[model samples]
Target: MSVQDSAETAVLVSEWRDLLARHAATACALDRELSERFGLCMSDFEVLERLAEAAEALRVQELAEKVHLSQSALSRLIGRLEKAGLVQRAMCEADRRGIYVTLSAAGDERYQAARPLHREVLARSLAGHRPAGG
Candidate 1:
């Protein structure tokens, strides 16, 4: 309402944006660092994490949805993971156009290796934050 109040609001908004951007950078960096440490790309890690929770296997589209990736992007990531022996794709029995992506034994090992780093990064990122006013 007042000029001072408006200025404070703007500053707060800017600070929030800056914090978000920095957090994004930190997340990307953590992913890169972990990937380098484990020889697994970020996308590859994500795919493995997803499969690790799956009871059997996941459809390619389902994987894409969980990771918020486009079909082509998911396909490329899946291809890399498959080539790395981290995952395998098979034709879906019920749907000819659908593909099922499953984690290989090697993928499970890589995922186990990468999980700790993921948790560490997440904990470090959230360490300084608290409930809005608490």
Candidate 2:
């Protein structure tokens, strides 16, 4: 490759790494705070937020996609939420093989409580990275 091409590639790779690092740092901060204040991890909070936005129960596969987690990982997360009485699983009547997940009343309450904290942290983190007047 030409020297210009190599330079461009290097810049792109550096930008990608920087993006990933920022995401990891912010996620870690949010996870720590959520765990300490709400007894919920970042994944748990993400699932709850998705459920809260849905109009009805969400299929496990659909939820897995929304949360960017593998189906098995999401299933395990749901299992933990279920044990905590924060969510419940139900069989789809029309598709007997399918399962759906819904946030319980307790889960709604928990999400409501945590929503402000989540927003605050996200806002603060994003603001720190924003260019002035941009």
Query: For model 1, which pairs clash?
Result: none
lDDT of 2: 0.94
In the range 1-134, model 1's lDDT, one tens digit per residue, is: 99999999999999899789867876686778786799876667778999999998999999999988999999998998899899999998888999999999999999998899887876777776645875
lDDT by residue (1-134, candidate 2, tens digit) is 99999999999999899889889988988898999999999999999999999999999999999999999999999999999999999999999989999999999999999999998888877776777886
List candidate 1 segments past 4 Å from native.
1-12, 130-134
Error of 1 at 8 (Å): 8.7
How do the predictions measure up, each by TM-score? 0.82, 0.93
lDDT of candidate 2 at residue 60, scale 0 to 100:
99
Maximum-TM-score candidate: 2
Off by over 4 Å in 2: 130-134
**lDDT on C-alpha atoms for all candidate structures:** 0.87, 0.94
